[model samples]
Target: MMKGLYCLQNAIKWYEDRFCVRFTPTVIYALYPKEEEYGWPQPWPNPDSAGIYIFLDSNKTIVYIGKASQMGARLDHYFGYGENGKCILKDKRVDDISYVQCYSCSQEEPYACLSLEEYLISEMNPKYNKTGRTEW
Candidate 1:
């Protein structure tokens, strides 16, 4: 887990260095609820925003990377039993989630969240990200 965390930390650093912009991730732990549980635990991370969300497994390895214009609604669609629960976290339970929230300035430049998502996906090669998964 430490190794995975270390790699992730380095990946974040690499993203910042390569992009010349630093996006600090807010890590939320124990967000995944069990089958018997009623719902997600209290004090859920503030999701009413836009950004990139990273799904991490028990070993702190990133399993998936996604971008959403509406973080809360998108998350709810996945976790709120919508669409028959056909979401990435269905089988691969997330031990925690880390998000970097940002609003893009304009279309003249690439969106920060999209760039970050793609970079992280390519660098980390998250298991569930069908797109942008690289050999690295």
Candidate 2:
């Protein structure tokens, strides 16, 4: 049974890669709104804060990791429409989303989320975080 599950997961991952869709734990959690007593609010403000997010599938596999200057905006872009093939939600391979908020070190200091993202990506070795592992 374990072997079969692994094979199925690998096959799904292969299809996702072919479609350029990445997954991580954070991404999986963000797909659904948090349960609220008063329901949900409209027009959620974009998280202007910088942060690193991970994308995961239903099985909780770390498929992708990314850093963003404006976490909310970047996430919104994934759900929004586009013609240049930058939208991950449109790819249909990603079924879930989640994110972690990162606070700045100081008012003047640059965002540390990028560094954290690099570290996590390196340590986890996610399949979709290829750019960070390469030198320009």
Which candidate number maximizes TM-score?
A: 1
Worst 10 residues of 2 by lDDT: 37-46
**Per-residue lDDT of candidate 2, residues 26-85 (tens digit):** 212334345641111223233555555555544546666666676667756556534643
Q: Where is the poorest 10-residue window by lDDT in model 1? A: 98-107
| Model 1 TM | 0.61
- Alpha-carbon deviation at 59 in model 1, angstroms: 2.5
Model 2 misplaced regions, further than 4 Å: 1-28, 32-46, 81-88, 92-107, 131-136
- TM-scores, each model vs. reference: 0.61, 0.50
Evaluated against the true structure, the overall lDDT of model 1 is 0.54
User: What CA RMSD would candidate 2 show?
Assistant: 11.7
